[model samples]
Target: MRFNKELKNIKIYEAGKPIELVVREFGIDEKDIVKLASNENPYGTSPKVVEAVKLVVDKMSLYPDDSMFELKKGLSNKFKVKSENIIIGAGSDQILEFACRAVLNDNTKVLMNKITFAMYEIYALQQGAKVLKTRCYRHDLDEFYDIYKKASPDIVFICSPNNPTGDALGKEYIYTFLEKVKEPLVIVDGAYMEYAGYKDEKKRVEPKDLIDKFENVLYLGTFSKAYGLGGLRVGYGIANEEIIKNLYKLRPPFNITTLSLKAAVEALKDEDFVNDSVKRNFTQMERYVNFAIQRGFEYIDSYTNFITYIFPKEVSSKELSNRLLQRGIIVRDLTGYGMNALRITIGTKEQNDKFFEKFKEVLNGY
Candidate 1:
């Protein structure tokens, strides 16, 4: 049985451990588990989204609207983009796959931050394209441009309010970078963009402004974070009609489920709910910051729903993660990313309190 040679180089992406897995592994009660690993909305989805989904339960027998008319219209209004400028996906990552498939080839090269989303390199490798990284861990546009001027890669990814790290690129910096690069297709993966926008006005990367300004840019957004619909898995891309049209050709039919479409549509109408969730997230986030400060630990200033606490070289991040896991508190260990750190999602007040309690107990061992 032969596989593509690229498979040998591609490492599987590891997701956050689930509550059920911990229960089975450690004999912990499900209720005791507080999962802050996946960056999910600790408050859950909007009530209106739930009610709207329930109304569509019996309709699952039929296929979803592949055209995605209503959801597209809602997004069009929200982002001020035309329907032709949009393409929906199971997650923002799928649109990323579409973008990769549409452009990447064996001889092509893709560039991104040294430590951004794992899926960026995964998708690029799937198409046999070479992957390039900036010298720094975060998004450094000057370094990216230095590579861009030399490599002239086909696709460039910028994950604003980047995953794992939680820092965001400023609006002026992004616009300036986009202005310099015209040939390569720049993918701005704004999965946590809502949280960034809420935290600081200058950090917001408006898709409307991006598309209106440059045809070479593709902006990705998801219902997963602030909208609290991660399980529903509905995401969309906004770009020039040409880029969107090319991506649409690669999209499978009826990609999003019936309930997902309804849920996303209803989720859009409840802006107040999303706004309230973002507000509450930051309030809880401060507690984590203070905890890090009081403990003499270092952490990155974040604009997203999660925070990454950096550990000293002597401390074992793996052991800390294992200790927390034993206590039924799930947090992501960045060991896989070659960092001695842990990325923790800011949970609800009650959940965050529990994490601090268990986390303190675990840290005492070190």
Candidate 2:
């Protein structure tokens, strides 16, 4: 059978190589692998979340609450938004798919930067729509504003502490952009909000600050990054009642697992766990910064747990990444993002130390 016309052109997303795979392929001990590719909480999940998951394991045969009342209520209380304004997804990425279905079609276009999250383009294109992107490396809202008028896109994506790159969009810039572009639906991907906010709460584009002000803007948040629930795949979106209402229709029944839903509820209660992870990541990122400086490596300024270090022209990113992988360490290769760099997630102190030891040895060889 033939697929939808656009399905053939859509490329599947390439996730980071898993640690289990590394062990299986190279015959290394499972304990020796250091996975710094995905921006996961190396410190692990909250004890509260673990207990919640255990309590719900017996209910796996049962369906999760389709309404997601407790999760939404929890989010509502935390973000200070009404439950009607929040929509849950398997992950924030799934909510993004819902957003594309709500706004994009053959006649519409999605606007974003050339170097933001790749999923924005993937989702837009999958909806059989066009994607218009900005022209620079810097996440400048001014250029986005100029392009918005010309492109007249149906949806706009702004990824803060943007993935793979780690540069955050400033709050003042977001205010200006919202003031200028009031027509299109703007989705701010704040997947790293907790970590970015910890760095300087004043500088980040807070979703709570905007839900009351702009009907056209939607905030995308996830549990995968900071909460250490990447394996469970639960995330959410915040917007006006009308936008949430439209996006909700497209969601499938029993979309989230009971374990994930219950675990996130507990994760929300454990703010101290989130805060400690943020503090540790911040300190480790500074350590990585010093390493880059002392070794003369070009690196991107990061506000999240991951730091993108650009390789010297003399070195190949793929080769360097392969070199690290052989040593039981893994990092994200930036070739897909059109950069000669590696995005390394700042892990726990011991994990970070191992990554650095291998990194130094690899660099010395080059």
Candidate 3:
């Protein structure tokens, strides 16, 4: 059977290689690999979520609640939005695709930053939308406004604590953009929001606060990051009831597993666990930033669990990553993200220490 031309042109996203895959490819042992690639909580899921999953596994033969009533209710209580305004998906990634499908059609223009999440570009391409990508900078809303004024895109994706770069846009910029762009749908991808530091600080902006003010804004969140439920793949989207209704129209039934939904519900209740994860992330990020400073490596100030830094010009990121791998440390080589940089996920204290030791050795030409 022949596939559609759009499907043919769709490029699959390349995630960081899994430990098993790397071990198989390089003939290394599993225990030796340090995977700091995916921005996962190195300390796994909370005991509460783990227990919930274990309880739900007994009913694995049954299908999940397609309506996702309980999960939606939990999210509603947590976010202070009505249950009708929430849409659950396998992951926030699915919700992103749903937004693309619900709003974008052929000839629809889309605008996003040049170095934002790669998935946004992929989705835009699949939807046959005209995608305009601007240069990367911290909260450069003026550039986006200029593009929006010209393109009048049907959709705009903004990732707070943006992926690969790990910087966030300010609320004032968002409010200004919202005021200016009335024609487009603004999507705030906050997959890393739980790790966003200084909730009361001047620079930080929480999309949840702006939800009531902007009818066109959609906030996407996930349990995969701070909750350490990446393997379960549960995420959610919060928007106005109208937008949620349109998204639900295109979303498939039972897109999320019963176990995942149950686990995510419990994950939300585990406030202690979430707080610990956030605290650890903040501490580790600060440590890493200091390390980078002492080593004279250029890096953006990060507000998320992962830190991205430019390797010295004399040393290639790919080469450095390869060397790290040989020494049982794994970090992301961001060549595909159009930079000679490496992104290291913050792990447990011991893991962070081990990684830094290896990193220092690598810098010293070990």
How do the residues 242-274 of candidate 3 rate in per-residue lDDT, one tens digit apiece? Answer: 999999899988898889888988988997898
lDDT for model 1 comes to 0.95
Q: Which residue ranges in model 2 land beyond 4 Å of their true spot?
A: none
Give the TM-score ranking, best first.
1, 2, 3
Q: Please provide, for model 1 over 1-366, each residue's C-alpha lDDT reduced to its tens digit, 9 standing for 90 to 100.
A: 999898889999999999999999999999999999999999999999999899999999999988899999999999988999999999999999999999999999999999989999999999999999988888999999999999999999999999989999999999999999999999999999999999899999999999999999999999999999999999999999999989989999999999999999999999999999999999999999999999999899999999999999999889999999999999999999888999999999999989999998988776
Give the per-residue lDDT of model 2 (tens digit) for 1-366: 978898878878899999999999899898999999988889899998998799889999999998999999999999888899899999999999999998899999988887878889899988899989878865888888888888788998888878879988778778878988889999989999887788987657666888888889999999998899999999999999999999989999988898999988899999999999999889888899999899888998998999998987778999999999999999999988888889999998899889989988998897
Count of backbone collisions in candidate 2: 0
TM-score of 1: 0.99
Candidate 2 global Cα RMSD: 1.1
The better-scoring model by TM-score among 2 and 3 is: 2
Clashes of 1: 0
